[model samples]
Target: MKVDGEVTTGLGKAAYFLSQEFYTKEFEKNLGFIPYPGTLNVIVSDEYLDEINEIKCNCENLIKPDEGFGAVRYIEAKLNDVIVGAIVFPAKTTHDENYLEFIAECKLRDELDLKDGDIVSLEF
Candidate 1:
């Protein structure tokens, strides 16, 4: 799956959850790296929303929380051909379908030199 959209800012609270030792440890173990303390927000294109939602409907498609954390689905993707990351949707999440959150081992914004409204390509 591939979804392209413009980069956007988040509500400025991801660090509270993402920076937790539990999730970072899990990410490092499963996703292959410890993510930065945040996610790169993307407003996915409307054309791809349905496909994303469809995956959400499939129970097997989601990555459940390790034990105490909220559930999230992980979709592996490539960013700009140089960086690798995943689109994360929290099962008990706050984001709308259009707003997909990208997480990488590195700080996505710094590595990508991204700003809000910059178009980002995500290939799964």
Candidate 2:
């Protein structure tokens, strides 16, 4: 399964959640890699709305956040054909339905050399 989205600027605030000791430990334990201290935001395409929604609805028990944190679920996804997939979910975010967030083993910005306004492909 896969979804599509473009790189978008976030509020520069994922570190708040990603850096928490509780979440980081779980992320490393479940997601098979130590996530970087932040996430990459993407504005998903409209065509995949139902798919993303399905993921949200049925993705519980996979890697949900512990108590005191916002809800989350994860699936592996590849970025730009790299043999990597990010764990994606929503938090106490202001993003709309089109927006998705990602966490991975390495810094996505550095791995892909991406910049704002880049057209990137995220696949699972």
Candidate 3:
């Protein structure tokens, strides 16, 4: 599946969660790299919202979190056909259907030079 969206600022919470050893270990084990201690947030284009939601419903690969945290499901993805990563969605996420949260081995914003409103595509 391919999803396109504009980069956006997140709530600044992923750094804390991604920094947790339990989650980082799982990310390294399941996604193949220790994720940078943050996520790159995207708001799916209106044209792809429904498609992303459908994909979300069918997704199965998950990283179970410790007590008090929500399970996260991910799909392997390539950002802009360059950097490899995963699109993650927490079971208890506050985001709606339009949001896509990505994690990778490096901080995506710095690695990709991304900023709010920049358009990017993810292929999974």
The most accurate candidate by lDDT is: 3
- Deviation (Å) of 72 in candidate 3: 0.5
lDDT of 2 by residue, 59-96 (tens): 75354566877866777777777747464676566778
For all predicted structures, in order, the TM-scores are 0.87, 0.86, 0.93
Please give, for residues 1-124, the per-residue lDDT of candidate 1 as tens digits.
8767989989877777787776777677777988888889999878898888887666353545567778766767788777887777786667777998888888888887899999988887
Model 1 ranges with Cα > 4 A deviation: 59-68
**Candidate 3 C-alpha lDDT tens digits along 13-122:** 88988898988888788888999988899887688877777787899888788899888888889999999999988888777778889989998888888899999998
Candidate 3 local lDDT, residue 84: 93
How accurate locally is residue 58 in candidate 2, as Cα lDDT from 0 to 100?
A: 77
Q: After superposition, how far is residue 32 of candidate 1 from its true place, in Å?
A: 0.9
Candidate 2 ranges with C-alpha deviation above 4 Å: 61-67
